[model samples]
Target chain A: MATISLGVFDWLVIASYFVFVLGIGYYLKRYTKSENDFFLAGRKNSAWVAGLAFLSANLGALELLGMTGNTFKYGMYVAHFYWIGAIPAMLFLGIYMMPFYYSSKIKSIPGYLKLRFGEKTRVLNGIAFAIMTLLVSGINLYAMALVLRTFLGWDWDVSMWVSALTVAVYVTMSGLMSAIFTEIIQFFLIWFGLFLVAILGIGEIGSITEIMNRLPESFNTLWSTSGDAARNGMEVTWPAIVLGLGFVLSFGYWTTDFLVVQRAFSARDLRAARMTPIIASFFKMAIPFIVILTGLTAIALSNDPGSGFSLLQDGGQVNYDSALPLLIARYYPTGLIGLGVTALLAGFMAGQAGNISAFNTVWTYDIYKSVINREASDSHLLWMGRVATLVGVLISIGTAYWAKSFPSIMDYMQAIFSWVNAPLFATMLLGMFVRWVTPNGAFWGLLAGMGSSFYMFLAVKFQWFEAKILTLSSVQSDMAVNFWRAWWAWLICFAVTILVSLVTKRQEEKDLVGLVKGLTEETLGREVPFLKRPEFFALLSLVALVILNILFW
Target chain B: MASEVREMKSIWFLVGLVLLVMGGLVLLAGVVELFSPSERQTVLADTHPGIWWGAVMLAAGSLFYFKNRK
Candidate 1:
């Protein structure tokens, strides 16, 4: 492995990219006319910007850096991330859940709840979603800082603050519009930069086929069929993969996560909004090649971890966050190395900015407007949104720095989201269609779901529930611990939501039709036509792409 | 009836193609072992299933790419 320092060429390309993105922020600043314009990009962003934003948010360095490292350490079952976990869930949400939000015409997702349910449900969702943004923003900013520090020896505080402030300035300056429009530039660099790293890396690995020829027989077992232990401490046993990654993580993220929803909510029309995630879904299916390849390549070049590479763990684990940047600095040539850095930075900003911008909007419109100051003027609300974004960015930076103390940033973020996401969905769905779902139901469901899940999380954290839970004897390793806990968390939250909602004044629980029918001032009601011709064309192309994928390998 | 049969046959062809690839990959693994047996790879093998999976993904993806629409 070679250590190539960042040269003048690399700096120039990266600095140029930064200038271009800031320029986009400045250019769009003037067009942000009213509160709507500032908040929602004047309700006019195209599919390309929306699509890129959706993808870029997910495309964060977390996956490129962290998941790539996982891929390097673990085998290819990482593909299950998109295939089993996200693809189906994405398509399902696009067809089923997205239309519910997009057509309902809510400014943000929780705003839709206010219309369908009551104010309490909206605020609960708003606050829950806001907390999610805080966690996500923190992780993303932390990751961005880590990438720079690992590469350039930049100070953590300086790196985190520089990136966070840039994102906040633009987002505060505009809103989703600024964040998304910048994504167009960011995604390009991320792809191009990653592609460059992969090409050079494969060459270093002594051709794709030669590397493939040396692979373990078990690695080819599509589902970890050979029954091996996950190297980097993942509790992915065989059956757990069937239920955990395949079911819960997939269903939970696609069905409930608002990062994707915010994108859907931002689209210009139903079709664009609906189809954007589907397109991004399929596009994501290709990411393992780039992210995972960089990971494995890091392994091949570093030659089993203990070689003092510092980038890789001796136990075949690469520092999940450093894998991508280390590879770029090690393998890529001068100018390209700089480009790669820019791209990784772009990936980080894309996630951090989207999180901050979204959290700010949610706080201002959903929680602040409804609960704190119901009579705030449009101008005042708009100003608060901008202020919230700035504060959100600062909190995110602080949290990112704090998260460094956690053992695994990736696992920590996922675990926290799991505690909250499923339960929130319970409240949301019941409030939507079940008109009789009382405001009390909303209140109690939030309390119970959050309370029970928190208790379950703590119980598992302390191993307090060892008496009743199932053991991992069948799985061949200790992998089932995380899976069992994930299931229990979602289950307990969901059960609490339903029981609390059903019993706490059933009179308030309105029927499904009446509640949803109340969601719009628009239509006499028409089902979103089964994705018009263009969308179907996109779907078919996506399928073809999948089939081609299977055949090609 | 003819169109249905045609579609069905193509579906099976696609499915069979998949089975063939899977079997080939398994066979390839066997060949690698028979040849290498005791050889430890020092050159760093990038054989993480993801690369090959990415290629197979092209097949899975083709199912989604529609040609029927304008």
Candidate 2:
């Protein structure tokens, strides 16, 4: 229950961040005259700009705190989220999927569904995505307020309202351009602010090797103990890790999530778009060095009785999320303390902005313009996008209050992803690769997939069936259940789509060109040499990924 | 085709400016704290990380600012 007091220098650092973001927003307003500018940042960013924004959109403070906490709980197995769970999907998206997405020039992912499937499928996805986005955004706001109130002694209402208003001001001004700018800044702030903890922790622990030596066998090695469910802290097997987390859930989130994909859509050219996620993959691989190492350091510190270090516990339950903030309190001086807090604040605000920006675009382009106002003008749609931004933030605030009343809702975030994105990924895969996939097939398959995933979650939650039946293991963690559920949902969707496609009428080959794989021409980065292509970098990224996994194993 | 409008400043330039200002402030605080240390010290306060890390930020910020400044 202790709070860290900020010095004058700390306040300065935090205030400067607010000023910079607001200034950036005000400055970019002129360039944001058109709907393209608001929704897609004018599609003029380089690979590096789009790449960092892509990664930062997903790198929220909640992930930082939770991952670091998860590390303290699950040990090195947590690194799987950053590595196998992410890198391959990112590479797949960049090298394979980006071409179709970019060439079609769709404003949002559901827009692509409309072109490939039908209006019903597009509206179905758009409505699901819009609801899912607002709920997650609201949860993020609640989590941010909780952290601020718990750690800095800030008022919860004030924290929520202040952060929400700041995001609204900036995003409403220039939209995604301002969002991308702030996201890039947040990327730097996170590195400079938090990477120091890993360094200082190593300084405290003597060495990285010493920290590893102090951990239990269940907590240190990544894959060595993953074969048997009983051998690891996560209580899951390698097959679960691979099929569930590594394959289905990973591909479902990374390849299909619009929050991240919107950044790639902002790239200036086709090659840049392809390279966006490829460039992000390298950085994604490096994040574990910050979160995983710090988690390991926390384990090493807590294990020593005389070190006088321990995690906070509330209501007799251990608060694992307190690890990173406690480390900041332990090592950061006055000035650096402010920088650390600012880094976390920037992360929370930028993440909220990313969600709202993506929501506004989907609302304006996919739902409102497509369903409600089919003949809306460019200027009218632009106006609608701004209104959506304000309304989205207000709904997010309302959702935050709702979450405050029922804290257990936070536990359902993974379940929500499985419900919406997992099945949608199956629909996307078939729609993109299989030319004979019918609109009816996609629509029915997606609904069945989403419904089944939700049903599976509720069944296990209410004890309608033993969770062991779903996980196929006697020992199960919530995380293990999530991974397995995503796999089943994807499998159901994938199977149902193929079955229904055979029974349904297919679209003409002419209508499928540039959307489906076999029908589309392979003209991506053809003029560029091997060394300059995204494939070369993706190969390098894959090699790095393999090496890191082997080294950790 | 030469136009009179000034070219828009790059996002990198803005990044550099924010880092430079924030880093300079941190470095200044670190220097002041080095001479007149706070009574409530952190775990490794004797090592003075604020000073060095602030300097690193300042240097990195300078490089970014000068390189990208229009």
Candidate 3:
């Protein structure tokens, strides 16, 4: 067994990265003098900045490492995450939803839900979102620690705590402002580091064709293999791809998750905010080339006996999670290794910071002030925000350890996302598009949706069903469980919301203005310029995605 | 009018400054890698990423920094 160690230069690079990030946080401290500044960056970020942060906030170890590993195991089928799953939903958010979010002047998604549904619904969502963010924060911390323990051979606890403390320091100081600024920097580092690995790996393999020749024919194609569950390198059928992930999970995350939407909310104007996710989708389209390609290159190199590389664990099986780290240690030299590892560290920290910051905002505005102390002053709220950041980080550290109990962390995280996000999005979609969805309907509907999802998860995992009722032919076990859970949950939530709304009194039409789809035409995106029209960009993004799919196919 | 112009100028100046600093460091790393012997290069790594990407960054920085300079 070979061990990869960091040299002095690597330490210097890592140290400098820490200093630069903390420096940005300290420098931005002056801007966060008020509660508004702490939560929303005073709504001062430009569209490009907001867009980059929007993209970067999601560019954590989950997307980078998890997707890379999945691509290694699943082949081109994994591109579904970036292309079909993300692009259309992001465009929809920018075109249709941003107007409502920006015009409403709401602090969080729960705050908006309160306006549309009622207080109980808001409280439920706020608590759910808070718990989900902590879980996600823990995933980032744990995944980074896993990678560090694999490469540098550090203790998991040490790696996890050190990473958490660094993120806690910056986020607690200047709030989201600091997280956004550092995310912009981390975005660049992640790209530079990944691009270097991709170029080198592709160069080694000779060409895309050369690399493709080494893998099975199905591995090179994306959509074609997805038609059959068993034919695709991964057992993801087109139905599951199109509906469960592309429709449900993607919309749930890009549209409703406060972590990313909050970045869009910090934009300077309605137009800028509208442009944030659209611009991100453009970059999101290109991410797979660097991320997924690196994984494929690793597969090709590791399979060749002469390459002197194999990411195999005991019993000569591939440890998919170690794909990216193994590639970094194999390809990059001493000094450059620092930059690559720094990029990974930046990704981990930025993700944790983004989660903690979102958690702080939701906790302070949605939970703390609304429920705990309604009469708190701005200064007092600001202090509470900092306190929440600390608490969020500590809880996340504990959740990081708890995450070890799961067999596959990525699958577990996605399953949790499916449970909460799908139902919340169903309620959100109904409340936003249909004005008649009463508060009682939405509240009970969300509860039923989440409840059914939880029951389905337990039933499938424990083999409670004698027959294969929940099983889908084309989808694998864990993902199949997730997709079915989300699909049924969304259905139950939608049905319950509609059923209960029929029994309850509806809100006045005047009050529904700018909140529902049909009523929002005047207030939403009334002044989009020719160049800034979201439809134009959406069309362009879709075209690019279609072309990539065809080329890969 | 002068103040608005000054504000825009400052924004661009800051952009240029950040670009230059980041680009310069990357370019420096590239130059060092460029001088290393060919034997030191690995098959699994890019032969000249530091130089290639560094030059690109340098060009972008120069364009932004020098284009609007007094």
Candidate 4:
């Protein structure tokens, strides 16, 4: 941990935003009038809020630091992973998959499975989703902890607890609506802060050409058609990037993840939900530019022959993830550094608490009450939701510290979660599209998917004892770094689900008319009443005003 | 309604096929790299052209969908 110094002004600016977030959290408390209000923002919110929240949730600490490290290391491959991989996935989601959830009026994805299939399928899907949601909690908490340690030099325990406390407080108090509003504010602060640092960096270094001239060839290694990241059966070539990053990351996110779906579920209507992510997709496209650019600029700045990038220590190879914070601490005066540090907190807490709140509501309403105890009163349920919030925060904070002991915790967290997610996604998509996908068929198929992927992941990830029965030694290599073979996790899961569904002759398919109830009629206006043009124009105006950075000071 | 639904479905199939193709190729390349660990870097560097191909197909598909929507 670095011995950090912040000026009084810096403290004030950082404190100001904290006050602002708390203000929003306290302010939105009035809106949490019921379980629905807390869970889904009363299902009457504007698309823009949903859109902003969706973007903020996606713009997690991963991009703040991990993507910085990624692009700094991999360069354009990171870009391809997004434009080539993620966007099209979102578009696919916006059109084809979203309708199923909206039309069914299901609270959680697992709930939808139960309705479409049966309780057996529901429990399977629920378990898988729970695993993924839990894994993600670990990943986000880990990153938040990292930022706090690097920037503020807080002890791991202190950082974890503070990060957890901030999120737990606001989330338990006000729920998703507060998370959204706070995110919109935090979203602006983070970019503004990052952009400010980026500008300072470029200005400090003088010109782009001057900056570019200072780097080694590796920093700018553009393409590698011949793959180099493959070590001992593990690989991450362009092909792998396309498959793992583009396909896996994209499809997995858009189709399966509830964070964004929760936003869509809360929208005024299906149209608003659809439009929200479109707006978010555009924002998603722009983020890597801001984040990656700041990181690259730090690289260029650090490469100036004698500039050791030692963070005041002896020259060290600049860890690109630390670029944003180091820059904030290095150049800004004390008070401004305070503001910058606080702004980084904005990015950290926005995603962290958002995940916690979503976790609480989903677990309480969808799983606990629905399955564990169905007859709880609303008041009891609300209290249970708050209790879930507290537990979710504690678990995430524990994970944040626990990750310190793991191998490349970020990557491991993502890989494990994908196993949970890949299975459920396969089953859900099949259930939606295939007519003969009977409830019984779906139940077993989903089980097969989860079982196959989990077996694959664990069989390789943990090579427990092997020589108990065989003549071999009692240990073997855990060869699970098979990024390449991991694709089959999805393939096997999807194929098995479909095969099992088709093999077991189910009863005749349910009628499709009910599913297409609102499709043909020009009920876009009636079904989804949006703000009139003037109101939309005014919303745009507010957004423009918020981005006062672009035109004005 | 039938016409629009047909158009959307047709495009969906077209796009899905292209995605599946691209996905297959990537999987092939990934499989190749599993045995050739060091070759992983070179494989991903080769993805831009494939990405470009996917992008072009996506654009063309979107155009087809939009053109028919009217």
**Top candidate (TM-score):** 2
TM-score of 3: 0.93
What is the C-alpha lDDT profile of model 3 across A1-553, one tens digit per residue? 4456766556766777787777767766765789888999878877788998999999986678878888788787788889998999999999888888899999899989988877889999999999889988987888888788877887988888988998889988889988888787777778766677887787788988898899886677888777767787777678777778889889988999999999999888888898899999999988987788988988888779999877758467667777888778766765567778888999999999999999999999889988999999999999999999999999999888887767366467887888788998899899888888999999999999888887887787677862136544624646655666777788899999999999998889888887888887665444757555767877888899899889887
List the candidate numbers ranked by TM-score, top first.
Answer: 2, 3, 1, 4
Enumerate the candidates' DockQ scores in order.
Answer: 0.02, 0.53, 0.24, 0.01
The CAPRI classification for model 4 reads as incorrect
Q: Taking the tens digit of each residue's C-alpha lDDT, what string does model 1 give over A334-354? A: 444565677788888888877
- Candidate 1 versus the native: TM-score? 0.79
Cα displacement (angstroms), candidate 3, residue A55, comes to: 0.8
Model 3: how far is B47 from its true place, Å? 2.4
Interface RMSD of 2: 3.6
Chain A vs native chain A, TM-score per candidate: 0.87, 0.99, 0.97, 0.83
Please give the TM-score for the first chain of candidate 3. 0.97
DockQ of 3: 0.24
Clashing pairs in 2: none
Ranking by lDDT: 2, 3, 1, 4
Taking all chains together, each candidate's TM-score versus the true structure is 0.79, 0.99, 0.93, 0.75
lDDT of each: 0.62, 0.92, 0.81, 0.59
Ranking by DockQ: 2, 3, 1, 4
lDDT of 4 by residue, A230-271 (tens): 321122445555565557546766667777678777777776
